[model samples]
Target: MDSSAKPILVTGGTGYVGGRLIPRLLAGGHRVRALARSPERLHCRPWGGHARLEIAAGDALDRDAFVRAARGCGAAYYLIHSMNAHKGRFADADRRAADNMVAAARQNHLSRIIYLGGLGQQNHEALSHHLKSRHEVERILQAGPAPVTNLRAAMILGSGSASFEMLRYLVDRLPVMITPRWVRTPCQPIAIGNVLDYLQGCLGVDQTVGQTFDIGGPDILTYRDLIHMYAREAGLRQRLIIPVPVLTPWLSAKWVHLVTPVPASIAQPLAEGLSIPVVCRDHRIRNLVPVTIMDARQTIRNALARIRQEQVDTCWFDGGGSLPPEWTTCGDADYAGGTVLGGAHRIVLEGDARLVWSTVRTIGGKNGWYFAQSLWRLRGLLDRMVGGPGLRRGRRHPSDLRVGDGLDFWRVIALDPPKRLLLLAEMKTPGDALLEFMISPQGTDKVELKMISRFLPRGLAGILYWYALLPTHRWLFEGMLRAVARKTGLPVTHGPEKAAMTSALECRL
Candidate 1:
């Protein structure tokens, strides 16, 4: 069978790299099957409905599911990693996932497996656990009967990438900083475009199969160099950075966690990996797959431009369990299941539903949360202190939002323009939560807008957490409703009445 005719299976199709790569593959006339744990996340992608692209809902760790997704695929891109796993079990999770993929590939007789791995010396005693896990996954894939093409890369710089976001927030938020010695360590960073080109190029070049290549940008520099370059690109004043030997990687990770949207779980491994020099040792892949490699300065410049334009295609926070809570969709008695606590506030305004929705969708990000922005910031700060993605993961676009896009700390689980927008809370909480806004026609020139907050408590703490904030939540919701009406240039015709909890259940449909 012709390779081009067979579909290419992408394991992390909902991830930062995989999300961007799938579109390229489709554009290149290759059939793509994107394997995602939560297929709904992929459904919101721009290319989700492409005729040549298929979404496989499955987990890589599940061998049977992996095999099912791999069947009939000419090759597979093994871009899965478990860096966001709870505690330090990411290594074990990654190992198990790789083993599952290997078995699946062997069973399905896959032609090749292309893996993107971190760049680091295997024998380096100071190698971080993150890079070690990546190296281990590479070995496991290569050990399979199917040929493996491994592309090892250092930091990837682009809009919405984890590394770029960390660097961006740190430099933007801090004018003067205390830094770790790793800031001076030499490193080679690659632009996301170059990385994608190399990834797709390998599929055409048969020589790339069964070979390992080190991929990097044109220039090699230190973290300090990246910081200053980022500031220069963003038009910020020169940053003052002080390198200190006393700060360990763990401490550095904690600092990054507080300063940036990247959590400590993901930041720690990255910080540790930066401690080791990561310059490319081999450039054989460069000759096999020629691409105009971008330097760090140009890459940073491009990223800032994208951010300003609000045109980020995919974000580092894109990958995660974004499935709506089962109770959210279940149509049962409000108290039938576990305790679900919620309050709904509705406002009758004299305007078209479209006008109200236009204002509603613009909530969050730099536009602010309408009312009590300082309170929102305080909540975000508290959430960040607990290792959650605060409000830093802003909305992808200013006025438009699709399902699965990150809006501040909330993920858009459901979006129906000019009608309904439901957001699932990503902030640290005692239990699962959802914030939804619904717009409905009230009368001739009137629209009713409802803001609902629901929480399915975990236990006693969850109950306490809800009641304690009951007063504040009411004020916030009512104020936000009035503010939205004002912003829409619509006069409030009636009450900002407190609706029954049962009204929250109406969102199930």
Candidate 2:
């Protein structure tokens, strides 16, 4: 690695693979230039705001954006595709995106392009739309001037990845699942961490530069085996998986959508794609990248650990309202009695705890809460009329907030510097309302943030207020995180709708 060479451009820096890859690139002593249509959506991401990372505000499909981002970079990582777009046009969109990246790389004189494509090959008669598109993208990229390094991977079992989460939700929620017969289809999955290792190792591997490698973990297992493996590790019962051949991919997808948060578009195509075997046919890259690959069981455990921690790396919602609220804890907790109704995201941002706290405290004042302003005001007014602080009085400062500052209808009852802030609702409706924000340094520069919103309903009013506002609250919190990522310029690869978004890998069948 030449220190004097220009930085690397990572398109889809906000995506699943890209999210994990950015950190590696930075850690490898390479400067990172990330392309995103909305860089703000990444503030909550792990690589969001490192000094080594330069976010290039642009979309992959935008020719100008792509050209500008790729200019002078030693290498470019292409990790994006759209299988969730308008009906029947996903492949076209993928081709166009590929064309854009190729043209940009050519015009910008990029040294190399590394792309992670789907692993399994298919006969033309049996190929699915999603896989075809993936293959097409690879071909398009290879035809360009830059030497394209394409790593074909199966399911990536990690936090926020689609195949991993879909399996996780199915296993966690159901003791028995009516799975399609495709459960027996063989596939290989790589741990997220191992995949990152391979990606980082490729940066200087000249032999891998112009090659296509099948990347997977050490073991090959049927989807059923994966379910059992995850179940045993999770300490759950071996799920009674009723595999029926009659259930078409479309029907199976519908089943997944109704039962899990995965959208129908992602599920259906994924279900159809499942009929094919996804086992890795080669181990050439592993020899070169040389990572200690995690087994399927371990991969599932790691994924569950992250999901339970609520630091999911992708969005799993079907294209609709914002993603649902999910949470993960760090090192400590006892469940207290209260109606818990808000989504919590636990992130380890690299900064002093105090700095992170100051950033949070300044939120929700003159700068406004990240999500819904009208909704917040309406709720604040209702609180104010009921003898609450309401929206009448704002916070003391837009940037400098104290522990006891009055923030609209909310009061800062408890404030622990660089560690915690507790807010007690001055509103009159609920029996008692509490919002606690806690931040602790994971390391010298990493801060772990936990926000807990607890409300004890008094009677009818509280219940009505909570239920009526539940839908909006879900969207708001989810979007608020995105807004936070955007505002703070955080580096996140994937998120809330991770499962849904990644579901396209399945549709390629």
Candidate 3:
């Protein structure tokens, strides 16, 4: 793409929406510059490798970085919102960021600016702090020298978004939940993909400039209805959600902290805001852009499917290209072989891990390995000569796995619903090997799964065997995780899933 065709500069590109949006910019044949606090931390899945996308270090808060990055750009996308991370004064932060953007855009003589804001009727007094902050940011942007295209959005139902992730974690952890009247409130839910469509559409529409749009998913339903829709689509029974009129936002926030993965800092404002209904009142965006809308249930199904297929192009949390950790609550051992491994994420769903392990554990005589049956039989044959269980023991469960079950040349050592699974290798090796599986919740129902393959080298031969297999580890490990995520879940990519990821920060944002 030519530099002149590059229509705009994108802020919060390291954010959930930005993470996913940058690619569309490239696809639209526009040259783009993305703002990041740490350029080195910028990890773009689809566009990371694209030459059209440039990562420029900048924080919306840091006037210098903001101004410097915005200069010489044709336009700017003010997609950065401070609600999840900045507390109490997120509005103030929003204002400052907006001011900096305005100043920089004006100084750079940019032609236009596009921003994504929350939707609500401000005149009707229907606005939460989140919405209010969004509105405030819009006003600041519009008053600037550049024409502004503001798209106000409703509940986004995609993977990595803060709100989406919060709801997802809450539902998965608490099969039964206490009541909160806010959940009964009505709102509009938009698919993350659809939102991206509008956002990318903003790049070309001259009518969009100086106008505001209210964006939403295809379905308009109460919060509870949305929840029910998500639950049904996730292949689970209707989740138990009890709403109490008496639970104030403050109290409810603490309750949310206990149930969901969202930290109190974000949950407080978000929970309080839930009291206000969020829906698109105008059909402005519909008139301006041509696109298809997805119902609540279909949105849920597609979002989950995307994660399971490892097709989630990006994540809100890991958007900054940050290195995420894999957690295990003990029982990860270094076996006598030369491998290192861990378990699966706990709260996040391993849509396929549960099924894969279930099938692999029933190996022996005829069952064989669910995937690599030949290798399993060969290992078993070698194990038999080495006086190992081989394939003779079969398994305690033909299809189900337990703490003591035996599979071909491995025995189940640890088992936990969702979080973990451990297997001790009984194969003919110079030493022992332990396989630990762990999965972690990342940006809603998405999971970060880590498979640990640990082996302690017995001696020189043991070391050689393990070292010889070291190169194999990369392919096997990457392929295994990718396969599991294809079955497990990737970060939610489109719509609300593309919303910012909120961590359960003990400290305020």
Best by lDDT: 1
TM-score against native, each model: 0.96, 0.64, 0.62
Error of 2 at 185 (Å): 0.8
Candidate 2 achieves a global lDDT of 0.68
How big is the positional error of residue 281 in model 2, measured in Å on the Cα after superposition? 1.4
Stronger candidate by lDDT (1 vs 2)? 1
Candidate 1 overall lDDT versus native: 0.88
Ten-residue stretch with the least lDDT total in model 1: 500-509
Q: How well does candidate 2 match the true structure in TM-score terms?
A: 0.64
- How many clashing pairs per prediction, in order? 0, 34, 45
1 or 3, greater by lDDT: 1
> What lDDT tens digits, residue by residue, belong to model 2 across residues 67-179?
88877777888888764622568887788889999899889788888898886665646667788788889989999999999888777777656676577778889998877
Give the local distance difference test score of model 3: 0.64
- lDDT per residue for candidate 3 within 1-509, as digits (tens), equals 33356546888876668878888888878878888764533442434667777778777888888778876688788888875533567778888989999988878888888898887777656457777878888888889899898887777777656577677767766778776888887788888889899988877777887887888876778878867777877767888888877888777766665554344556676775667777777887787888887777887787777766645544433432111112221333332123432222122233344453443333343555334445556766565554444664444334445343445456554556555666667556775566666544555334545556656556778878877877656555544444443432343232111111122111100
Model 1 error, position 398 (Å)? 1.6
lDDT of each residue in 195-219, candidate 1, tens digit only: 9999999999999989999999999
Model 1 / residue 29 / CA error / Å? 0.7
